[model samples]
Target: MPDNVLENVGEEYEFEFVDVQSTPVVINSLGSDSADVGLLAYSSLANAIQNEMIPGGQSVIAPLTYDGPRYADTYNSTSGSSITDINGLDGNTLGVNGVGSAIDIAARVVLTRNDIDLDNVEFREVSFGAMPSTLSEGRVDVGTFIQPFFEMNSDDLQTVFDTTDAFGSFLKIFVTARDDFIDENDDAIRAFLGDLWTGIEWWKDDDNSETRLDIAEEVVELPRDLLEALVQTDRGYYHGEDGLAIDPEWLQKPIDGMAEVGFLDEEIDMSEYVDNSYLPEEANTEPTIE
Candidate 1:
């Protein structure tokens, strides 16, 4: 999402952007009432729900994006050699951003889906920025990094598989709010969501490529050409021209898969945790993209 996407919402509503470390921290901030609304990875949200970290919190919207191949690139060391597939990870150490994070859970799902023995592999915690360097120095056999990293270091890295390869059409990120906040600020919430929808639509339009690239260049500090290439690649924001929407069935699948993989102790109650009513009418419908 853009840094100031909500700027156009209007004078009546004000939005605050809090930069945090991880999804768990985002959930904790929400639960502690330190944050009014926050976005979190689907798995982390599930973790919060399962552990009752955020009581009466509801997922207001899930910004679904689906470019095939996704951002989950598992790679070998600097040589970009030695690993060919999931089985290649056996008996090797895999570096992830965090142990119990969304990426960690995604790595588990991908590895287990290939029938790789989880016990045979060691998951080491590595920072996102350091993942490439760590893998290059032989500190870890395999490591995962998100966009621009893979694009930036393709020569030094070799892809085993992306998360989409293991679990197709997964929920990427979701927005959550405390029930009290939603109850008292319904109109403000609607206005915020409607403006958010406008931004998503603006972002997904092919005609806005240059404008988007300019913004990307300023924010990510990358070359405009590289950002342009990423935009061309089937980057799945999973949203459609219609608007952003939360699909119960879509949301349930990943939680169920995570639970099945032992990342989550139990299944989550979707009805209790999701409040689609806060979504703008245009965004409350089924997802327009397949």
Candidate 2:
């Protein structure tokens, strides 16, 4: 996440990225223990959605996904390889950075979608950065992943499918803030939300263009050229095939799936959790995040 989300909300309030990609459940479990909002990959967020674990009785925004014009470093979509089919992973241990991380939920989503019983498989939590090795070492059949890690490991593994294959599209890295926060500072909330789009735009096709690489370097400590490949490779932010607009339908399906899997304790309506009022009503139709 950009510093703006944390540092520029207003005079006093602030927020920042938590790197919840590692042990997301730990972070989610810590809700209100530390910060008011949580940043989760669409897949990891699936667990919360599945379990109805959001702060209020609603769902968080689903992150966007897209087919890049360039090559993605992720595994093969239809190719016959280690994960030739979903069943290929049956009984095979799966790798995730953390138990509650998005990769875990996303991988589970794929397995459940394929009717694979998760009880029969094991989810080995490792560093998201090290998942590729877990697979190469023959420790797991496939690795659950996000950008860079997903791309970085493409050399050794083949994706049975990606966000589209698993969930019809990539899940959103949603912002889950308290209802009180939204209600108390509607204007600040709107400003923060607008900055989110603008920040994403800077990451995505910005003319300055180093934002994505810089993110990789800052977050992953990768070299500039290496970071560029990590971002520019067939990975990075969404501009989904259909377009970049947020898709509620895309979110609903996965949330329903999470509920079916016993991740959620009760049935909750999406309407209760989401309030799109912060997004410019007219700007919701834009193709990219900004």
Candidate 3:
């Protein structure tokens, strides 16, 4: 957590972190005022806004990460599978984390771009942790993996393609708050964004890479060696720029792609939903390092 590294921020504000794995639950929690701020994939948040799940819609405060060359959501098959490439996936079993999740949408976009008929392929919803084993055991011909899971099991799995091929460097996850919540607690939101930027800057520095992995190990159940491997290969998280600012141009790719694949009811103008006012001044400036 950011508070772990930024003790002074924690001293100023009190925070209670809740682990809600399901995206729908996160949306509902925000709607009911059960959660102040929520983390959501681009698809989930866009769907919630279109459907009016949250009272006054959501205000996207900051972007968490984007799918890019260094790191991205992946499509994988067994090390020695018959399906060697994206074109060969026709009529084969495809596994996704969820049917309508962000990864699922990305898979559809990739398949569509390859001219693979969506109806001809079978999609099985599997957990990320189980995807590797599921492919290894022949339960599914191909599975989708994100982050450490793909890096951890790379030796046993072969990549078919990543989301970058279809969506380019698109927005993946972001931080959001209910419209009413932002209106009600302006100061708190700014403080949180400021603290979050501080944490992001600290995490981006090369000097603190080992410490970042250590913090990751403490929070997640993965081993230190595995975490080290992920960091060493640059397969870890990619928080864009210093202040964690939202880039409308990068976000538009997914918005257009989701509509093209019918994942979203209609394309949305992200400018209306994104609120950069809450972010600190540093968010607008370029990073000192890269």
Candidate with maximal TM-score: 3
- The candidate with the higher lDDT, 2 or 3, is 3
Instruction: Output the TM-score of candidate 3.
Output: 0.92
Model 3, range 1-290, lDDT digits (tens) per residue? 55366643565556787789887789988988899799888888878878889987788888777777468888988888878889878999999989888888888888898899999999999999888888888899999998788878889888998888878777778888988878887888888888778787777677988888888788887999888876635586567654456667667777777898987777889888888888888775532222
TM-score per prediction, in order, is 0.88, 0.72, 0.92
Model 2 per-residue lDDT at 283: 44
Report the C-alpha lDDT of model 2 over 90-170, residue by residue, as the tens digit.
Answer: 877767666644445556777787888988878777666666666667676666666666555556556665545544543
lDDT of 2 at 233: 42
Shift of residue 164 alpha carbon in model 1, Å: 1.6
Candidate 1 lDDT over 40-72, as tens digits, reads 777788877777788675564546443333344
Model 2 regions more than 4 Å off: 1-30, 41-83, 98-101, 112-119, 211-216, 232-234, 239-245, 286-290
Off by over 4 Å in 1: 1-8, 64-80, 235-242, 288-290
lDDT of 2: 0.55
Candidate 3: where is the Cα deviation over 4 Å? 1-4, 7-12, 286-290
